[model samples]
Target chain A: MKKSGSAGEPRPLSLEEIAKTKGSTESETWELRLYVAGQTPRSVTAFANLKKICEEHLAGRYNIEVVDLVKHPQLAAGDQILAIPTLVRKLPQPLRKIVGDLRDTERALVGLQLRPTGTEVRE
Target chain B: MCLPNLGAESRMTKAVKNKSQEKRSLPKSLTGIQGLDEITGGGFPRGRPTLVCGSAGAGKTLLAMEFLVRGAMDYGEPGVFMAFEETAPELTQNARSLGFDLDELVKEKKIAIDFVRIERSEIDETGDYDLEGLFIRLGAAIDVIGAQRVVLDTIENLFAGLQNQGILRAELRRLFRWLKDRGVTAVITAERGEGALTRHGLEEYVSDCVILLDHRVTDQVSTRRLRVVKYRGTAHGTNEYPFLIDEDGFSVLPVTSLGLQHEVSEERISSGIPRLDTMLGGEGFYRGTTILISGTAGTGKTSMSAHFVDAACRRGERCLYFSFEESQGQLIRNMRSIGLNLDQWVKKNLLQFHSSRATFYGLEMHLAIIHKIVQEFQPKIVVLDPIGSLIQAGNKRDAHTMLIRLIDFLKQRQVTAFLTNLTSGGDALEKTDVDISSIVDSWLFVRDIELGGERNRALYVLKSRGTAHSNQLREFLLTPHGVDLLDVYVGPEGVLTGSSRLSQEEREKAADLIRQQEAERKDRELGRKREALEARISALRKEFEVEQAEAQAADGEEKKRERALAESRTAMARSRKADAADTRKVLKKR
Candidate 1:
């Protein structure tokens, strides 16, 4: 895991690194950033659910960066963040956003494009 | 979280302390918009959110932006504009057309702008969340500028950006509470919904004040109106005021705000024509009174107005003439034909002419523009020539209301208004289309009196309040020298005018000449009769003298014979003394 120690600091993977990794497998390195207002229970749960999903889908090809807007409020304007506990997928061709806590793992995987949306596996 | 909670509690305490001092009336933050403060009884509620809801292109965003700009510039209150739709540069460019320099204000740090763009395609829903990030950003903006005013332009975009309705609703309520706790006045704009005040029912949240703007097109004429749906803790004007959005920004026209409280003036002014003045109680229309001159087409309505304007300008007083049917140059040239030089007054800045087509704008816009110009010019006399054209530009009811408001405004300033109306030939000459005759202080009716194969213009004072005006009809003559009012010829055949009057006058002159000749002949005949009587007397005298002579001669002859006899007898009587003495005594007696 690549970590950004400071709160509200966004560390995006270089495009060259992503492009170089794209030839080896059909899937590339997944770059995710979790935005939160403060250290809330919902954000902690969303971060844990994200980690589990990334490990099960592609073990060593994902990067997660946590951003706390309460520390640097001006950063919210860059991502147009209104709701807390928001997760942004930045490395993909098209950027995506997921708002709320990751309490529903299957729905969270579908939202992050880790699993197919139509298929549902019963617990 | 604990520190923010403590700060909110302290702010709440400070607000509570201010409430005591403001117990008598609700403290209001002035919006500085023209005519809006009057209708709102000052402005929006202080430290509270006001909901401004309208449909698309209804000027909601512009109104909110104006509120902020005016607050910062006029009221010395810094504002923060949180825009959900437009960026700062886009907003600045749009406001620049209305004479607002938003960029300068932002540079001066008098205003803070934050654009929140939410794209639904890019946003996804995972689980539970709140809008705390928005709160932090807003708080930071407010703190940076020390803003006293806040504007959330179309805050309903949050409903589209987020998926959780329950959390969004709860968080919106908390946000409003937080804004209030921060002790700043706020304006929130929302889109109008079908059968609801706002699309997201935001009115349920911001209950202090609600203003609705509407743009409607009727008969191909669009008018923008603003109505304060509800204003708590104060009495506000309930009428829907017509507002204008032009290069000068928003201006609301409160029609019925000015009641019948204008001070009346007993001083009368001249009507330009001496005969017309004589018809109007030997003085003229009352100062600061409305005069309506109603007539059919080509009845000298414009000529009469021109005469009035000339008279006012001749008095060295300012005059403003609004001509809806004729251009300024055309009116000037036409008035010149009647011996009235209006261009000189225009050059001298004593007379101003505002000429435009009646259909160029809606009735409300016309009224608003008139108000603006009147305020700027501040003329003593105002003349609206042929108000009939303006009346036809709008519906009858709207035209009447606008006139009432206009008259009230002019009267309040002690400005005399001279309005001309063109009535249709088929309708009664006494009736006007707008039906404003009853409210006018004086009414002049001009009509075409067809007589002896000719049509003549006749004018009479139909009504003059507080003046004993003449009831006689005078023939209106548009002479090259000027307007002339002649005493109509009243004869056994009724009122005579034009060629028939001239003919009647000529016949009377001929009859007078014949009567004078007859009197002279009678005098001559009397003189001849007297001379003949005198001559006859003299001749008679001569004839009597001749007769006397003849008689005397005859008598003399007899006397001679008798004397001879007497002489002979006297000689005989000499012998006889008695006869001689008697003859001598007779001679002595002779």
Candidate 2:
């Protein structure tokens, strides 16, 4: 039912990784790097928030590599990062991105068109 | 798709990119309409639940039924109808008049109609459980009949029954996964929210595809519409569409409705009227062609159709005649005078006439009856005597769709169809009765002409799909012998018009009177000259007669004088005087 492009080389990497990874990988795995500014209260909160959420939501299926923008400004431009806190869900389908501290799960769910309720996630 | 740093500038770009992405993977489906499937690239994704949310009475149920019935009947895919509202008996009865024998379909095991009665008080969700119970039933039925379609009448019922949004939304999410995993195309109906796609805001929940049906009253004219709100992963039509629900069930008409999908025949077949056929081309209307005859009232449209049926009957091809204006007996008897005896055809089982009053019923009923006959008779040629009468059954657009379905249905069977419409005006209106001209392969326009001081009936081939036709308007006359296309009435007046013919007759009478006066004058002059010459000759004869009489008297006197002179001369020499008198008398006689 998911009519993935009948034409076109099945793009194995995200657009950024495709540009950076070049020949280093052949696994066809989506590697995502969520960039943040400094380990300020906002950046710490965003990292802790994304770690637990990814484990509970995506469940060990994805890898969320957090990058600190204050440490490496060059990496900010590499991923085209402008905000301090951003969560990028790069995956098997359309790679989606959400910026800011992941406080509102409703917004994140809508952005991804993900079913909001897990068997235990419902309040 | 490019994204700048998440600045305000990038934020604006993200919105644009979001719209563009939404446009890319649009979810499209057949809607099962003729030109529409091509537009949507072959229907919605199967088994992926499509949300059909609309305002009140927007034809959501009608559309869902149409899709399911079309699949079951046309596509041979049995369907399952799960209605949270409306009982099985009610749905059957509601659609029964539309010729949808849901009851019969259920009996045939071709379709399963289930009423999911949800009682809120009964919901003792003391234990954590998904609505997998309902899903299991639907799945079982689909597996039982190999049903390909699943319709949930109103999705709002779920929210209405379950007060806990957390539990309800969770089950809603699970339902999509369950249906998609099962791989059966599903259409779930929902009531529209005040402004959002659905009242429960479920547009984002189960929307692998989304279709919105709307009923709008613009300028006091209500138009029911259907729109593919959003369908992911398919290229779909984005325009709001108008649909109709009549007896034939729900029929959706695509925005750009006309396209040549089937191969049209270049070969023309006989319309049974030799005159009309010859004018159309050497042959006649093709066996499976749709012919439209349109004109004003009393223009022999019915008679022409009757002639065609009579001809078909003679040739041993069955014909179905549907008359919206007159009774069957009236049609038969009226046509009898014009040499079309339907009674004979009836006996032969070659002609069937169905006559009904359009105003006596509804549009859906008319379509149902038409569809029913098309299914039953299986005639070689079908004639809708005057489609104009059926326009009264519904608004103009409904009539168009019904006629389209009818035409498509007939053409599939290769049955030639003839429809007549009484166009509104005499001024050569730029528009037709209902754009019936679009669906028909051939258009026959019969018009009344005013020329030569006489009213004449003329028939012409406005358009014949693929043949060399005579564009000349032939004099069409209805008589006891049948309809005839008279030869060209060539004259200085050119083709004789109604008033021109009458005027020519009037002018000819005046010319005859003038010629008569000129001939009488010539005869009188010849007689007068002859009489004058005879009178002059008579006068001259009288003069000659008088002269002759005097000459005779002088001769008599001279002879007497000569005798006396002879007697005197004999007596003596004194006869010299008598000799001189005699000589004088001789000179007078000479």
Candidate 3:
């Protein structure tokens, strides 16, 4: 839950807004905020894995925002991030949070409520 | 349904396995709640979840908060309080009133408060949701502070926030297991269900211990009680114990532990009044004994209490007087009239007066307040003037139970306590509700003896354990000097008291004077008769002497005549012989 949002105050850029600013199309854009504390190995691995999953499934519509909580710790409460390596989906109708490194691609995808391209037939 | 995540499942299995290993006997974590440790044998089971279910306003939240606060402050165990119903600030404010400085504790990192703001309208529960967010938050908070204790206050508030019950229940069970796996003692408060211990049957999951708090009202008096429903692998007290939530926090009086195992003292103390002390055997009451002074109104019960307090104070021992009927000033003034100057004792800091209306709180609260005050003041003697006022606040059974517990507590501490109870109506000496005569070691009954058309106070030692007390009744007199008990005079008209004794003494004095006066008059008359008889005898003797003298004179005169006659004969003879011997006669005449 986003507890507070100061209207006139400067805030960190979301991945979708950054993507739109980068001249990406506005149709069905995926926005995600990956919270990390410093440049730890687990955080690095989580970011790499999240990028790989987005590049493979959503090449043109995906965006990822890396928020280093060590530098901006106050932003953790805004996204309700408790764990060190957490990925919050901000653009989706229903916000979803996944804790820990995204080592298991299937579980991370399922936790973030993102379906693979051919998952319909698999189900 | 095939579960996609094995990580959480494996963690749950590991927790369950560890808990089963501890099923033989659970270790304890002392709750630091008064009298609760005695009942639970220690406290709640450690490193496991204890469910606290109670109705609204039943003090469930306060109990949980106290558990956390006491653990952090007293035991050096850091705690995390996860409030699902109240915000952090609100909780801090509420706890501040109870003297739990949550803000300072939070700042010191001894305890962490995380308010879980989950509004129902703001959340959308899609398919396949879990409480992993909550787990992460709790785990992070615990790890940050290295908390050994965790309190989830009012977990039922989640039901209002979350949409799905099945998922919530399953996730909650997993959460409790996780908390146990984390090896932190957890207390989960829940709203009481209609027919179950908790609304969602949460007791089945958090089954190590379950405590139920109830605030019930009877006859317009509300009493808060706590009961331990179950404590797995440990023996616990099953009776319902009354608890109080006040500024000092929660205190539960273990009703079942009030056994007669307290140590007795051979040391004797005076009952304040020397006469009263003589009535109670030769010495007085036992030093640590509970004394019950029962009487009707205006029978000098409070006055008797004041005397005991005064005696304790005079001994340089600290005393506490709990006046439920009179204010402190009024009590000091009233006692001054009876010659007990408690004000000086107060000034010397040897005596304290706690005056409050009896109806100010319930019986349990009153007991808790007394316990707190006694602990703080550490008085050597305690006087609860007219404990009967407590009976007016609640049921008779509750008052009786409270008295028994209070007396037990005092005796356990080796404190001399004097409780005065006003016996209502009649003179049968019937045991009233506030009558603790059975439990006390000494029972002094002050009665108003209505004789001689006036009411006179009388005191008698009805029962004094371990001492041979006097059986005679004494007329209790409350004079300006002090309390003095006069031996009741046994007369032909039964016990003489008041003006009748005075009148009877006066009558006896008058009768004695009359008898003494008549005897003196008779003695005087006898003396006058004896003096007159002696004078008459003396006069008779004088008269006899005079008569004897007259007789003697007559005899002398006769003798003289005889001599003269003899002389004449001799002269005649001499004359006759003179012729012959005129010269010889003249020589003889010469």
For this target, which candidate reaches the highest lDDT against the unseen true structure? 1
Model 1 spans with C-alpha error above 4 angstroms: A1-31, A54-65, A116-123, B1-23, B545-567, B576-590
Report how far off residue B330 is in candidate 1 (Å): 2.9
Tens digits of per-residue lDDT, candidate 3, B1-590, equal: 11122233334334433554464656789999887876676788899999998999999889999999999999999999998888888999999989999999999999999887554433333333445556767777888899999999877877887666887788788888898899999999998888987888765456688999999986677889999899887766677778888788989876435555568788999988888778777898899888888888899888888888888988999999999999999999999997778999999999999998888888887887898889899998999988888887887777876887788788888899898887878645757555456667788888888876899988888888989899988988889998888977787768887787778878879999999999999999999999999999999999999999999999999989967865775687677765546544654674
In candidate 2, what are the lDDT values of residues B38-97, reduced to their tens digit?
Answer: 334467666688788888888778777777877787878788998878878899887777
Error of 2 at B253 (Å): 6.9
Tell me the tens digit of each residue's lDDT in model 1 across B439-481: 8999998889998899999999999999999999999999998
Better of 2 and 3 by TM-score: 3
Better of 1 and 3 by lDDT: 1
- Give the TM-score ranking, best first: 1, 3, 2
For TM-score, the strongest prediction is 1
State, as a TM-score between 0 and 1, how close model 2 is to the true structure.
0.52
Q: Please give me the DockQ of candidate 1 compared with the native complex.
A: 0.45
Worst 10 residues of 3 chain B by lDDT: B1-10
Query: What is candidate 3's TM-score against the reference?
Result: 0.76
lDDT of 2: 0.67
**Rank order by lDDT, top first?**
1, 3, 2
Candidate with maximal DockQ = 1
